[model samples]
Target: MDAFEEYLMTNLPEAPSFHPVFNEALQAMLLAGGKRFRPRLLLAVVDAYTPLLRESAYPVAMALEMFHTYSLVHDDLPVMDNADLRRGEPTLHKRYDEVTAVLVGDALNTHAFYLIANAPLHNDAKVALVQELAYSGGIGGMVLGQAIDCWFEGEKLTPEQVDFLHEYKTGRLIAASLKMGAIIAGLDEKMQRELFDFGLDVGLLFQIQDDIIDATESSETAGKTTGNDEDKNSYINHFGLEGSCERADALAARIGERLASFDAPLRRSLEALLKPYLARHKTK
Candidate 1:
């Protein structure tokens, strides 16, 4: 993972533009740094199954990170969450302007597909990778989740509804990261589906843990704006802190059991990447 982070840092995609600061704004959030959890999930799968292909898989892993970063940029826009900080730095809109922030997000979003399209993989695999990412991050998945979340702010929802919202908003992309890795490694559809299902649980647990963080941690500690879910339908809002923690605990256990079911190599790689994250809710 450390080596992968180094690779990501040095290999940010370039977008030549004549407009002043356009290129700079485009790279700001990405270079500011993030957990890169989604990319790690993708690369871990590739490493476990096809160690020799790790280098080739770097671009695909980077595409996942780029897509995730674009989401964060848009989410922080004044029209959405209106956040001022992200990844421990001023958001694009705050650093530049709303127009720059919006365009930068759009650029990252489209360039993510471009990365997959040009990845050093088979034509069929590249097509599959593009399809998987687009569906997961597009209107049917993450976009729909965000729409539901923003449209229903200050409105309480059922637990099942909340799950549905997060599943699309957060879970699908995480699931896609694992499944996309499986596609690159030529894993059969059955195993890919299994990994995707497990990833959804992990994603849900992540959202719940984030809610706990928003409730308990400071913005400085979180490296982003905190306590921003007060009007939004968050797990912590639906279920108080204790209940949300218990829910995260149960979900983490389920993820653990699923992780154990995988073959040894895959399990080991994912365990190393995910163990700390699975139990993050308990840390606070």
Candidate 2:
């Protein structure tokens, strides 16, 4: 198996075969393909800070993915983005019906906490992970970001306002994903911060790349409708293509500098992750 695949297989959450609904929900959720960047980053974190923390960080990482998936599911709900597709498949609500989709998302989000809180890892470590996930996923991060995005959509925004919207809306979880990894390994605050900073830049670049892709790629290639942000403010809309490209490059380069401080393979992988954004710019 690939390193990522192995990492995923190693730390699966324990489920009673009897909980058919719960098991089916989880399976349905996981089978949906995502970038898996967050969980992998968490694993990378475990590798860097303390691989010895567990024989498998999979369950913990998967928990984070569940939370993320929950966000996506809800983000596409009728009252939200109102999208009809995801991962090149019918969205949960579209496929399973709205009630099923909403409940499934709720289940995943809560179950994510359960998995990490009850992880076979050390109690202190598991407790810390739970807090991190909650803080990042709750008011501090993804949910708040979505709230802001919804509130601000179809409205005018200044540069700072746009930046704040983007940072909270998308950048927070990206930063948290990295910090969660570092925290899982029990890294000190200073080191954890450095990783968080690195995550912020990379996460920003990821969002910018999405903008560029939306501007340049077709809906078929991107799996979601392109130009959806045409009505919404984005780095590309405000900064324009060339300016966004310049910003993405500068951000990625700075992240590269920070990644250099770490000898860990995960850090190296993150640094390499920037390469795709850079390459995407050229294609655009």
Per lDDT, the best of the predicted structures is: 1
- TM-score of candidate 2 on Cα atoms, chains taken together: 0.88
Best by TM-score: 1
- Which clashing pairs does model 2 show? 11-59
lDDT of 2: 0.74
- Summarize candidate 2's per-residue lDDT along 1-284 as a digit string, tens digits: 56655665554444566754555555554675668878877777776557676455777788878788888888888888777767766777777678878887888889888888767777887887788788878887778878887887778789888777777777778888888778778778997787777777777888887788878877777776566676577888889989988887787777667777777666665655545554424534
Cα RMSD of all models vs. native, in order, equals 1.4, 2.9
Candidate 2 lDDT for residue 78: 86
- Give the per-residue lDDT digits (tens) of candidate 1, residues 76-96: 998999998899999999999
Tell me how far the alpha carbon of residue 31 in candidate 1 is from the true structure, in angstroms, after superposition.
Answer: 1.1
Model 2 stretches with alpha carbons more than 4 Å out: 1-26, 264-266, 272-274, 278-280
What lDDT would candidate 1 get against the real structure? 0.90
